[model samples]
Target chain A: MSIPINSSKAIFPGLITREREPVNLEFAFPTLDGRITPAEQFYVRSHFPIPEIKAEEWRLSIEGEVEHPFILTFEELKQMPARTVMATLECAGNGRSKLVPKAKGLLWEQGAVGNAEWTGVPLHLLLEKAGLKAGVIEIILEGQDEGTISEEPKAPGTIVFAHSLPLDKALQEQVLIAFEMNGEPLTAIHGYPVRAIIPGWYGMASVKWLIKITATATRFHSYWQTLEYAYWKDLYGKPTLVPVTEMQVKAEIARPALQEVVAAGSIYRVTGAAWSGEQVVEQVEISTDDGQSWQPATLLEEPVRYAWQLWEFAWNVPPTPGAYQLRARATDAAGHSQPDTHEDMRRTYMVNFVAPVEVIVK
Target chain B: MSIPINSSKAIFPGLITREREPVNLEFAFPTLDGRITPAEQFYVRSHFPIPEIKAEEWRLSIEGEVEHPFILTFEELKQMPARTVMATLECAGNGRSKLVPKAKGLLWEQGAVGNAEWTGVPLHLLLEKAGLKAGVIEIILEGQDEGTISEEPKAPGTIVFAHSLPLDKALQEQVLIAFEMNGEPLTAIHGYPVRAIIPGWYGMASVKWLIKITATATRFHSYWQTLEYAYWKDLYGKPTLVPVTEMQVKAEIARPALQEVVAAGSIYRVTGAAWSGEQVVEQVEISTDDGQSWQPATLLEEPVRYAWQLWEFAWNVPPTPGAYQLRARATDAAGHSQPDTHEDMRRTYMVNFVAPVEVIVK
Candidate 1:
């Protein structure tokens, strides 16, 4: 069967569209309810126009900084031992619109994240067969998607989408080279043949439409790595530009969407998802009294690393008829709580702060 | 006789009240006109309750790192060569409400800025009389007002509000130890006894209720200096925390308030003010076509050094009825233009970006 190019449109009815050409979509956070986001309703983030790589024609190449290099066909890659995992993929710029002095990227509003279950061959198994060489610092995963940077900090010409993972992260048994999502073969728009699911990191680490993998002896820095996905960190007491690795501690209220109206004196179930990468979100607190105090929300399930915990807060509305603001704050197991302020510096990535929703009660 | 403490309340009639105890006030931007903001309508920002330092009882101490230390009472400070200059005092955190996630500080709109004719003693003459010692790095300016920081990144008990300026900035002839605002003596709420007017810096640099002036041989690091007013800057390729020095190039549209409605086919005279600290705002541009295209606005007066330039744009609205966003951007002589987007980091202060005002046409 022939693959469809740029077919992500119209299929997902509920996603908020930011860009049409590159197919950037945010999930309808107010509509979807459940721990696992349905495949049809999952968000889509594309660096370039969706490349049509047929399943039969695709081959995964493993080379560079390895003792033995090999290429595996789609069927051969699928023949290897497989594993299934549930992980959340959050774009680094998910809650960017919430930042004051809104940054110059897609005006995303806390919906650019979704959880999914996938079946794939463990990447470490493939890496074991390839036999990583000594002194290897990174494994660069490349995607078939190629495009030129059109915005500020513009790059020269068309370049392929690529990202590198450290040896330890690549060797993690749960990291997958997946071909199926939610019990079905991957849809063309969702990286059909194979995609690397890099758990515990921002979605950018998971290179989609996997085509080639190169184990590098030195740190691999690409346009997306150093320029786009990088953020300022205080490394050694300096505002050092470092590549974004882990997802920040964040909680987003999905139910009772922004600027909604509700009845006074009614129990509004404030529901949302709290997530962190590598770290566990220990508590999700809801603030209905305009942040003077907070009430702990009930987590629907036990904390899972690299996955979002579904949380609900039963907020009994006061009988007073007035406007109300609902704010959710998530604190990770590492004691990192969400601060509702922005640093003076304004880059366009990694916005994990708490954003509030305003509702009028009548 | 006793001096009244924290008496900056209920004096200013039209000021938008954010906090009552500390008396944080924003000017009614849409209501005021003219270059010099009226004495009764000026904006006020206080770290603590307005200290009522009576002119008779107030003492200005000019001590530390100096060949000759001296003290001056309010009358003595006013006797030392007074100069009147028109300058704009803008809170560094102006327009913070426009930030997406809504920061933790008082949600200041564009009204947290005002231009006034400040008459005061040139600080350089005072420093000249004190005879600066060699190796003096910074001049610390202290206010009589003291309070504990009740917010996040909270500090210890009842600290005095103070800030230090680099030696070069302190030596500028226009930096004031003034006892007068406009043609009248300083108002009770606007630093009753004496205040500093740091031209080309945010209002925080202009200490109110001035009580002490200290010269330090090394970097004078204080709570407000390093913690509150500091921002992360890429120093020597590092995101080093640096004190926020100059006001960023910013323009605020006052004529067309946010979310206003107007006639479709009428001429709308969009007016605003543009000011930059130390930097000369060369041009002010307005975008009526949703930021896709920008048109230059007419600067009403010559560009003042440290004062805002009033500007107007005559827009011939289209006959068709629809919604439109109006954005104003300023470019300084240094070629630094206002960026529409924010960087990723979120700190509490210094937001000088272009914010749009939405309007509907019928």
Candidate 2:
């Protein structure tokens, strides 16, 4: 049996629908412990099939644009200088299903996000050993997991799996060729044995089950990574689309989901999580009357970077009957604020918008 | 064998760490389908022992300042107006260990967060059934999880595990007495059969494995909920501490952790998450150079209160040979911003200041 998550004390269990939606959500809650969302209580999002990889058979191949093309088994990779980091991983479609006009796909309700510790070797070290070649403008990656969505060769925009990074990024030390997660080897569903840790990029760019690598001056496109998942929209009424990449600033209330009831005169805790693609979250504020006024909530003791941070606030309810609209806002270290909507983006690559929740005061 | 989450293509043998460290990171690569971190790929944080909850024998009792005090089994609770919702839950200490000067306790390196669809009875239904009595200023909850940690209870401050909800919040329709998570019955580690789904509070206030409810005019205190886990600091040179309750705005790069490598001259998808505790996320900005000119990232979809919203940006790398410091920032709907340091919190609820990643270039 899968280990259980401690969620009974969860604050925002059901603010949208009464059933847990298999997607993304804006979570809010009250907290006493300074822990960010406990690992077990964190959200989850799965795409494709949850692959199961064996460590013994897992081998990392560094072949493209390198002086030495070699395949190193998991054991060999582990023997190399192992680097550890604490980071968060999010899905490109984390909150995609919640878009207005409802895009064609699963109507996910916000369960596709999570944070964890990932351990592995930096890709630069491996690349240095391989000896990067000149003119390697693009680095293409291919994974072992393949599938046929239909009987036909699906459009490159539909089924093939691949992605690329610039030679500069490929050589950067931050680009890790990882094999472990959260102080342990990667779990099957996560990229176990060997996977690329490409910080500052969307999940699409980090190819799992890596089996092949090629360096090219031109771009390498894959059905899943490039065309299908790319974000397209009308820019100033002009049809334009771009590939999904960096993250945007956003937040949600996980505790007081819509329609939650609290006894009159009782004090309740409020809390939730926040993050940005490349920025550090500066502050999180709260308001009870639909953004009428705000107060800064307490933040957890996590270092902010390219990952999620947990936050919380305590709301004192007045003994009165009324309707309350709750909202949370975030700002980053560079002075960026979350937007009310994604209307300004030429393409819907990221959706960093302010979300609100309605609660009834009986 | 423990299902390895790091393997990209398969699920098999791996080890599980009992305690997670703050700086220990494992890299994760996305699968063919664009999901880098799936449900199983996420981390788990268990505050107390995993509760041994049996759905068949489980019971949720609503007592306190109510006209009717009764205990309802899981089945009975489900018989009430059932509600379901998708929300994220985060531990307050999600990134506590990341704080500089090294705070005491678990050194989690992210991965203490998750989203889920929860289904269950609303706490309002139970409150309505009980008919809350006047003068009940707070609703205190006690979970079945019990343990005694060997630590000296400091004067005026000690950690405990009890939370209070004000009366107005108790009547909110969103408050739930949950029984299911993500369409499945509650897992044992999660509150099984019956648990409190209080949105907008930290996971601790949700009170997993709930067993009792009491009404009081004064605040209820517990070691886990108060002294031990919450934040502490000096007020004007005087030792002053603040209990962590509310959330703050925060963000981080989810995909490419620090020191990751990427090919040069290729477009990479940069993604991250952001959220606020007071208002909705208004906007997220990205900067390749730390704190340099910022560009807005794409914000995806509507978010519930207290939940982190997903965002992304696309970066077409420039052929360069220098390191790049990836940076991100966020603003809330009501015009709040994240901070640059946890020290800015003044009271030190463990909220770290925002910072940018230093990605070494080739």
Cα lDDT tens digits for candidate 2, B121-210? 777777778777877766766677544444322211222244566667656676677777777766665666566767655555676677
Give the CAPRI rating of model 1: incorrect
Model 2 complex DockQ against the native? 0.01
Model 1 regions more than 4 Å off: A1-362, B1-13
Candidate 1, residues A81-187: lDDT per residue as tens digits?
99998889999888888876556668888888998887899889988999998998788888999977755334435677888898999999889999989889988
TM-score of chain B of each: 0.94, 0.82
Judge the docking of candidate 2 as incorrect, acceptable, medium or high.
Answer: incorrect
The most accurate candidate by DockQ is 1
DockQ of 1: 0.01
Task: Tell me the whole-model lDDT of each prediction, alpha carbons only.
Answer: 0.79, 0.58
Q: State, as a TM-score between 0 and 1, how close model 2 is to the true structure.
A: 0.45
lDDT of 2 at A256: 65
- Residue A128 deviation, candidate 1, in Å? 41
Candidate 2: stretches off by over 4 Å: A1-362, B1-39, B154-160, B232-242, B344-352
